[model samples]
Target: MASENVKLEPLGPNKTGPNRIQDDGIDDYDPHLHREVESPTTNAETLIHLLKGCLGTGILALPEAFKYSGMANGIVSTFLIGLLCTYCLHVLVRAQYVICKKLKVALLTYPESMKIACEIGPTCLRRFAPYAPAITNFFLIFYQLGICCVYIVFVGKNIKAVADEYTTNDISLTLYILMFFVPFVAIICIKNLKLLAPFSILANLITLVTFGVVGYYVCQNLPPFSSLPSFGTLFNYPLYFGTTLFSLQAVGVVIALENNMATPKQFRGAFGVLNIGMTLVTIIYVGMAMMGYWKYGDKIESSITLNFPPGDVLAKVIRIMYSIAIYISYGLQGYVPVQIIWSNYMAKSLDNSSRKSLYEYMLRIGCVVLTFLLAITVPLLGLFISLVGAFCLSALGIAFPAIIELCAYWPDRLGPGRWILWKDIGLIIVGIVGLCAGSYSCIYEIVRSLASGQT
Candidate 1:
C-alpha cells in the first residue's frame, strides 16, 4: 500500500452535470478516479496492509487483557469492541467521502478531513474549524508515539528475557532499551517509505511464524472452560477496555490505506476490505486472548511470548524472532509522527535552508530518543498499553470520528427522525466514558506500582 505521501488536492467548485450526477442527488465524484497514486494497491493487497496495521505488538497483549476481563466477558467484550471500532472506521471513511464530494477534493488525511468537516459544518462550530486539524493531529501524534513506546518496551523485554536465559549476568531492561538507541536512530533515519518496505515484509513473515508457534504451544495442553473466571471486577473492565481498544483500533492507518486503494469504494461494504480484514483480525485476537489466558490462567505475562517456557530453545527463538519483528516495526510506527511533524510544522520553516535535510534527521533522532526515554521511565508494558489506548485511541478511534460525522452531516439528513444524531451522541458518550475511566484506572495502577517501589 502507498504511504501518506499522497498529496491532498485543493478544493474546487462542485461539479454539476449529467456526468457528475447519479440516480440519487449525491454527486458522482469518485475520489478513487481522482486519486493520483503512483502505485495503487489492489483490494487484496490493501486488505493485507489493513491486517498488518491492526495486528501488532497489541495482539501479544490481548491474553493479558483477557486476564483482567475474564474468559467469557473478555471474549464477548473483545468482539463488541472490534465491531464498534470497525463501524467507527466505516463512518469515518463515509464521512470523508461525503466531505470530499462537498469540497470537490480527491482525498484528505485524517486531520485534513477533520479541518474541512469543521469548516463546512454548522455555524456554531465554524469558528473552531481552524483548530480542528491541530486537535486531531495532537491525538494522532500521541497515539503513534505511544505505539512506538510500546514497541520499545516490547523489544527490550523480549530481548532481555532471551538474554537472561543464556548467561548468569543480570542486565537491566533499561540497559537493553538504551542499547537500541543507536540502532533505532539509524533505522528511522532511512526516511523513505520504499526503503523500509523490505523490512516491513520481513517483519510480517516473522510475526506470522511467531504466531503459528505461539498458537501451537497455547493449543496444546489447554485448560477447560471452567478453569478461568467468567467475569472480573468492575475496575478491571476498564483495563480490558483499554487494552482491547489498543489492540483492535488502527484509526491512524485507516485513511491512508483507503486513500491508496485502487477501489476505495470497496473498502466499506459488507464483503469489502474493511469488514473482511477486521473480521479476521477480531477472530485472531479473540482466539489468542481466549487460548493464551486459558493456558496460563492468572499467571499470564503482559505479553504472551513471555509465557513460553524459558528452558525451551523454540521458546527462546520465538522471543528473539518476535523481538526482531517488533524492532523493525518501530520504524514503521514512528514514521507517522515524523511525517506529521516535518511536513506540517517543520518543513515549511526549513524550505529555504541549505541544511533542511540535517534538521529533518535531527527531528527523527529526537523522536526515537523521546520514545526510548518514555519506555525506560515507565517500562510497565501493561499499564502503558492501557493508558495509550484509553487516552489516545478513545479520542482518535471513536470520539473524533463521531464528532466529524456529526459536523459533516449537520442540519439535515441524519437518517429518519435524526437517528444518526442520537447514535453519534451515544458513540461520543461511550468514547468519553472509556477515555476517563480507562485512563484513570491505568494511571492509578501506574502510581500504585511506583509508590510501592516496583519497577
Candidate 2:
C-alpha cells in the first residue's frame, strides 16, 4: 500500500511528495488564504498577450530562412513546426493543470512544472530530481536573456542603418544600445503585467502596420518564380529549422500568460487563445515568408527590414515603428526570467524590507545592462537568433515537454504495448538532432563569415 502510494502520489511544487487528492482532484488546504496578488487578465487580453509574444524579430528574418528552404518547403515546414510547437505547449499545460488540481494551487509556473514532473517520475529517474528547477531556470534565463540581446541588436542595427542613410553621422551600434538601455530598464521595472498591457497592444498595432507596409513593398515588383528555387539543397534545411523554430518559439512564456488569465480555462478550449493565436501567427509567418522570398529571392538580407528603400518615407516609418515595437516587446519576454529569479532565488534569501525592494530594482536594471553589453559585443543578430532558436527552442519547446508527458503518464504508459513511449522517444530524438545540427551550422556560419571579414 505504501509503495502504491509512492507510485501514485500527486506531485508537489518543486518537490516529490504524496499529496492527498480529494475525489474532485482538489486538496483539503485552501490556497486563497495565502494568495496575495490578483492576476488580472481576461480571455481577450490573454489572447492578445500571446499574439504579442509570438510575433517578434524572428518573423523579420524568415525571408532569409526561405532563401535556404525555398518557398514550397518554407510554407509546409513552418505550418508543421507551428503545429508541433502548439502540441508541445498543450502537453505542458495539461500536465500543469493535472498537478494544479492535485496540489490545490491556482497556478504553477514553467519551472515549477519541471520540478513537479521530475518529482512524479519513475524511481530510477528520481535521483536527479533536485536539479530540475535549476536546469529549467538555466534554460529559461539564457533564452529570455537571449531574446533581450536580440532586441537590443535589432533596435541598435535598424536605428543606426536609418540614421546613417540620412545623416553624415556614422554612429556606433553601442551608442544606440546605450540610448535604448534606460527606457528598456524603465519598462522592465513594471512588476505588474497589467500595467504593461496597454503598451503591448500598441506595439502589436505597430507590428501589424509594419507588416502591411512590408507586404506593399513585396508586391511592387515581384521576382519570377523560376528565379528562386522551389526546393533548396538538403544542407540548408538546418538553417530553415533554426529560423522557423526561432520565429515560433514562445514556450518560455506560455504558462506565464495562462497563469495570469482571469479565465484560464478558456486558454485551451476548441477555439481557445492558444489555438487561435498560433493559427493566426502561422498564417502571418507564411504570408510574410512567401511574399518576402518571392519579392527578393536569394538577395534577402538577414532582416527583411534592411531591404527597405532608405529614402522612402513609409520605409523609414516602418523601420522606426518596428524598432519601437520590438523595444516594447522586450520587456514582455524579459519578465518571465526576472520573476523566476526573484521568486525562486532572490526573494527567499532576502527579508521583507525596504532594502529587499531596492535589491529587486537593482537586479532588474542589472539584467537589462548585462543583455545590452552582450548584444553590443556580439551583434550578429541573425546568427545569434538562430543559435538561440536551435538550442533553447529544441530543449524547451520539444525535448522537455515530451519528457514531461512521459513522466506525467509514466506507469500506465510505461508498460508493454504503449505507443506514447515510442512517440515521446521519437520527439526527443528529433529535438536532440535539431539542437545539435542547427546550433553547429549556425555557429559554423558565424565563424566563417567573421573569418572572411563579413558581418
Q: TM-scores of the models, in the given order? A: 0.95, 0.88
lDDT for each residue of candidate 1 in 230-256, tens digit (9 for 90 to 100):
999999899999999999999877887
Model 2 agreement with the true structure over 29-136: per-residue lDDT tens digits: 433232233656777878877887787888898888998888888889999999999988887787666655555565566666667677776676666567886887
Specify the poorest-scoring 10-residue window by lDDT in model 1.
16-25
State in Å the error of residue 83, model 2: 1.3
The candidate that achieves the highest lDDT relative to the unseen native structure? 1
RMSD values for the candidates in order, in angstroms, are 3.1, 5.1
Q: Candidate 2: lDDT of 259?
A: 62
User: Using alpha carbons, what is the TM-score of model 2?
Assistant: 0.88
Model 1 ranges off by over 4 Å: 1-25
